[model samples]
Target: MSVVDAWRPETAAGGFTRDDEDVAFYTRINALIHSDMVVVDLGAGRGSRYDEGSAPFRKSFFNLQGRVKQLIGVDVDPAVLEHPYLDEALVTEPGARLPLADQSVDMIISEWVLEHVEHPQEFGAEVQRVLKPGGWFCAITPNKWGYVGIANRIIPEKVKNALMRRVWPDRPDMDVFPTYYRLNTLARTRRMFGDGAWEHCSYSANGTPKYHGNRSFGFALVGLFQTFVPSLMRTNLFVFIRRTA
Candidate 1:
């Protein structure tokens, strides 16, 4: 569920696009974080984040010890115990409540996780519950209105899982979950965060046809989606939020 961060254009022969604006957006958020911050990584896998992939919690600059007070990883799979980037890990039920105390987390980050949430409304409330007043939230998830998204919405889950297994066998099935895409659009984000009184720091659409290895149909569809469609139709959505007092 990772995309290339390189700034490749949608109109290029490679049929891929990159929205580096997300990197810049994250840079701003990174500057706001301090060494004493208590960060929670929602749905963080076994630290599979990489260069082409987003960094662990999408914060490469703060990866070292003492860079941040803590980075807690929460996942549905116990394999999260293998997460190297985490100071602590918590395994939870799929779509169940978070285990953290109320108003405890200073920051919350989700990398490609918002899409798979079974119930985003309740989940958003949970996020607000765990985050302290004035706390920050940032995330990267696929745009459900994008090219790959349209295809995914139409394709059956079983078919999609089969495709994923064939396309990305190295990635475990536990890493993949049913995508809801409830928070995929700009309007949807506004309704979710704005209604909760969360301050909107920034938001953007990022990435391109990196899915399916830039194959023919996906490449063509995503290229067109990146070019002709609006930003909401891009491959990924980058959102930054701040909880209000």
Candidate 2:
């Protein structure tokens, strides 16, 4: 079944989700926001840039407009300052410290972002510093062993950038960053986040292939891939953790 259809039932709590992971995630975020808590979205590119490839997931997030007391967007690319889903935007250097105060945020949402960080462990530290006690950080990232991630690690940056620009011409106009598979795998992610040893953590492999385009054959091919390949080889991974101290 398509991811969106899979998550249809749990839209009950608040917001929406295209997959099981996001259902649990948005449910938690919805509850926190009902309490007037603050949430930050990392790598929150403009909603306009959310292509057909990820539109369903993006729509679920967009559905959160008035539900949250406050939703903040932070990105290395200044163009994301225009994210419609965010109350405000903070643009900073790609691995620079977050502008938020320590322990000030109730939740962190990161979508298709962790793989691009130059220093994944440092990003973990920042997440630890900004999140309040019991605050959860939820992320969707590509698995390094997946076909897409292997291509990213193997391809030269300039060539890949050029290819992406050629294929998805709008990236240059919106926001595009390099991918470094540094924290893509479950083990690496766990070890890095272990730096803070946030009181609780969970990781789940999202059994979807990332190489698909908007075509049915593309979708079917990936569906076939997932059916035959091991779960670990699938493209998406979920990283959920909470700061309890």
Candidate 3:
């Protein structure tokens, strides 16, 4: 089930469109790349999020474009373990202890993964544990209070839970992603890192389309409104943290 043996590049597989903000968001993250760094891509998806000829979960393969020395991808999904660029792939339950040695990783990157994790605190601790002292941990997750988040929240909790069930009925106990954003804001996200162990470098609210080629002015306005009214932008949050010993 290792990626090296299983991966097969497909030309028919489409890539992410430039219209989505994720293109810019990922590019910005790519700028931080250094050729010598050992990067771990957590929850690295199928690589369709970036481009063809690329693996989904390991953004460095598409984003850094070979600037990275080594890339490791970790996800619970067996399909993701088959990405071509993954130097190694480990399958583990989301938010459980990662199967990596202490202080072994120089940088860790995850996109849109926090919402899927059942216990973010444990996940954060795992990130801290695997990172070398002064290593970087970067992630993007939906802001629970943003426009999309508000729309989700205004629904009855029972309905929300039902929707989660309908989408991922296979894992009844798994929190169907984006669960914590409503309660975990920028301030709260900073707090979760605890004491001086971590520092938040940035926080921003942006639009994330559920569908391709479907950008709307109304949705853009909502994102803009959330900037001034932090209470409104509950849909997405991006953060960069440096782990300190």
Go through the candidates in order and give each one's C-alpha lDDT: 0.72, 0.70, 0.64
Q: Mind giving the per-residue lDDT tens digits that candidate 1 earns over 1-245?
A: 12332334442433223444445545665777888999998887777654344534444553533567988999897877888778899999976789899999999988778888878888888898999998988887777887667767888878977876655556755566677777777678778878666888555554544554434555555556577677666666677889987
Q: Which portions of model 1 miss their true places by more than 4 Å?
A: 1-26, 50-65, 165-174, 212-221
Which candidate has the highest TM-score of all? 1
- After superposing candidate 2, which stretches have Cα over 4 Å from the reference? 1-33, 49-61, 157-173, 207-210, 213-216
Candidate 1 least-lDDT 10 residues: 1-10
Candidate 2, backbone clash total: 0
Better TM-score candidate (1, 3): 1
Q: Residue-wise lDDT of candidate 3 within 171-234, one digit each (tens)?
A: 4353244454422467766877867888678576565333111235433454456456744454
Decide which is better by lDDT, 2 or 3.
2
For model 2, residues 89-162, the per-residue Cα lDDT tens digits are: 88988779999999988888887888888897789889989998888888878789876788788988778777
TM-score of each: 0.78, 0.76, 0.71
